[model samples]
Target: MNIQEYIESGILEQYALGELDDAQRAQVERMATEHPEVQAELEDVQRALNAYGEAHALTPPPGMKERVLANWQAAIQSEPGQAPAAPATEPVVRQLTPPRSEPAAAEIAPSRVSWSMAAAVALLLLSAAANLVFYNKWKQAENDLAVAQNQQASLASTMQAVNKNLTYRNQELAVLRSEQFKTVALLGTPAAPDARARVLYNPTTKAVYLDVRKLPAPPSGKQYQLWALDQGKPVDAGTLAAATVAGDSLQQMKDIASAQAFAMTVENEGGSPTPTLSTMTVLGKM
Candidate 1:
């Protein structure tokens, strides 16, 4: 099988868990030794499982050592050469007794056994609980990683769509540029001598390219309004945003008739019903 297919076959997980039989384990180990990538994947899986196990080890029972010692002592006593007396049902409580004090050892043996058994059961339960918690945490992390990967794929798709749209728009702009387009340079006026703009008007197609690259940004509550002037009176064209100053061109509406000049003024956000003639920034004649 291919490396990717082998990795996906669940054998790696089984190997990590040590669930494979002897022959299968040897085969996996041999493959891992031969393939660095497989080795790395195996190491990662093993490390994760090892960490989970360490975080969930069972604690030995309380007084287990004493109980085992008591049982060993009894076994030794039962032997022919040994002389130590067999401990009683309840071994002496040495924890509360002075070492020098002579007490019946069997008095506390049963209590020790009981305590040891209880502690052993408790430790087993705690180990099980810890294992379950670690398993859940691992599952949750895996789920989160899957979700993030899915989101990344979605974002990549969206970017591809946006790039396609931009390419189409650029093609359309090239077509427009090829037609009967007239370029009009709008000079900065006295009120704002630093601001300038250009209008690329295609009379045949009735399309306008308003390039406002040299224009200053409008105030927060206002935008720049374009007008098509006939004689001395100006006709409303369309509004442009502050983004127009950042080298991004704006496409205005089409079909302007008998326009002798173009002018721009700062007006309210939606633009004024009439041009704010006093705040005019740039003006240009056709």
Candidate 2:
């Protein structure tokens, strides 16, 4: 248990006010016995209560002594058989009609004003404490809301990315299954004996897609580019995206209107207008 949090929870104040049930009082006592800080705080709360009462204690009105003396004399003079005006023994009746005192009134005015001001200050303190507690709760609620909104946004972003990946895979699956597309397997060149890839072509639509089976990681600042051979002349197809080069997925390259052969060669970050024949990695005849 957090001792400071427990102390500030106002349970000690309730205990000081004698508002706790027997079970609650026992619990507080047990805690106080176990924790010296709790015991000290409980003592301070009790002392503050006692001080407030003593500060606000009522003083006897002036001439109280004279009134009591007068009542005592009257009670003694009453006929013995009458029980000495039975109610005369009560001091409350005499106290209600205290004789007006100019000096006493003068002294009481400042005390009354001081007591009223003290009461106002006490009320202000209580109000301030209540506001402080409410403000802390409001701040905690705001923090919790912000955290929840961020988590919800993160979850939404993750779901969108997953859905996009699923859509791309579905399209790739359709292209692989369709009979309209012709598959061309490109065998590795002498430069790279193990490199292999396949190209899918739809002659009617002139569409082209590349699916890499294996490819070496490119050198820094270099990328793989595809070319279409038509009548012994090379036409630039397009460069591969990193995902395609990594064999992560099928990549749709630039459209090819006509071609007798297809090949890949290493180029700069962007493809060159003409292929570097010496850097050719794979070639295939359709």
Identify the candidate with maximal lDDT.
Answer: 2
Give candidate 1's whole-model lDDT: 0.80
Q: Write the per-residue lDDT of candidate 2 for residues 209-281, one digit (tens) a residue.
A: 9999999988999999999998889999999989898899999999999998999999999889999999999
lDDT of each: 0.80, 0.91
Task: Score candidate 1 by TM-score against the native.
Answer: 0.49
What local lDDT score does residue 62 receive in model 2, on the 0 to 100 scale?
94
Clashing pairs in 2: none
Question: Clashing residue pairs in candidate 1, if any?
Answer: 88-106, 90-106, 90-107, 90-108, 90-109, 91-106, 91-107, 91-108, 91-109, 92-108
- Residue-level lDDT of model 1, residues 56-93, one tens digit each, is 99877999977876786577547835534556622553
- Candidate 2, which ten residues in sequence have the lowest lDDT sum? 93-102
